[model samples]
Target: MKADTVGQEAADGLLPVLRELCRGAGADGSLPLTPRALHAAREAWGAAALLRLSGIARVLGEVRLSRRAVFHYSNPDCPCCRHKLTPNERAFLSLVRAGIAGQKTAATGAALILTEGGPVEPARNAALALRGVWSAGPV
Candidate 1:
């Protein structure tokens, strides 16, 4: 079978398993898989392929994307310190808040980036800053 076909098959097969894993983890109060965890999952699933193709990795990519969306929707602030938030966290929060405010995610992301003091080299920093501003409130 072609690599793409194999990958699609693998991903389709793995989706239910992955979802079950996530649901079980959530039930146990464990956080969803981190990037590293997702990578590991991809590797484990891809092991079946004699020659791993990029398509085979899409299963993990979808997991990561779903996780990101969940994280963004949750708008989790730093538990230890509210002032501090990760870039991904910020991006997610921006998406959620903007959605709540009836704004589009793309526009919100762009506006957040533009509001930064200058060019945002490490994109994450700009994202975090935008989240801070969007979430900031009266002291």
Candidate 2:
């Protein structure tokens, strides 16, 4: 845990988020040492953690590449989604918004995650998940 993840007791809840980070960074996840840690994490967290990470990276990538302020817009309704924002997502979104506004919050290095060329890097592959979530995603 990064000491900022709200509601969760420990870092075990962050495996999915980490996986998203690695995935967004284009990691194939085939490193020799990755499986051992992944297996342990999977055993500890179970399948839901993995399954819940759907589209997070894509949405975050959109947010990172956003030229407009995401927090300024209302999150669009999606009847297909059966979930809402979690405390963790709210907190992370606040941090990201604050970071974007140049506020001096604790979520340092958020700028790094908003890498240039992420959105237009691959054939306008940017996702529409950002329309549903201005702050965070399913994870």
Candidate 3:
């Protein structure tokens, strides 16, 4: 993940938290965060936890959030290459379009998707720094 996307601090802290969550994942080996669950988690565990979960969600390719302040693209095709978008690219483009049209409910939500990934494989870490941040009210 690019540090610039979600700020250096959040980028640094996010991976370790995701690693911890991966270790404790359910039998399905998937970590899913519904919008409702994400909001509830924020209320119970503070906004930091929501940020962490959003980071993981972004990695899982479950959410796409535009970092740009303004929408630019019109065609789903590659602007420079002028080629048809791949399926993944099309999905991302659709999400961005939905976001622009204010049709995606997730756009109103607080989860700030930091990076893009298809299937993320988190590295295991011995220590988790985010444990405290989860219940610490706010950062």
Number of the top candidate by TM-score? 2
lDDT of 3 by residue, 1-139 (tens): 1111112322233323333333343444455665544544455445465765654444333332222221121231235422222233233323333333334343322123322332212210101222333333432
- Colliding pairs, model 1: 72-92
Looking at model 2, the pairs that clash are 1-11
Off by over 4 Å in 1: 1-83, 105-139
Tell me the lDDT of candidate 3.
0.33
Error of 2 at 1 (Å): 18
**Model 2 alpha-carbon miss at residue 97, Å:** 14
Name the best candidate (by lDDT). Answer: 2
Q: Report lDDT (CA) for all predictions.
A: 0.33, 0.35, 0.33
Decreasing TM-score order of the candidates: 2, 3, 1
**Model 3 ranges off by over 4 Å:** 1-11, 32-46, 61-139
Model 3 TM-score? 0.24
What's the residue-level lDDT of 2 in candidate 2? 21
Q: Is candidate 1 or candidate 2 better by TM-score?
A: 2
- In model 3, pairs of residues that clash are none
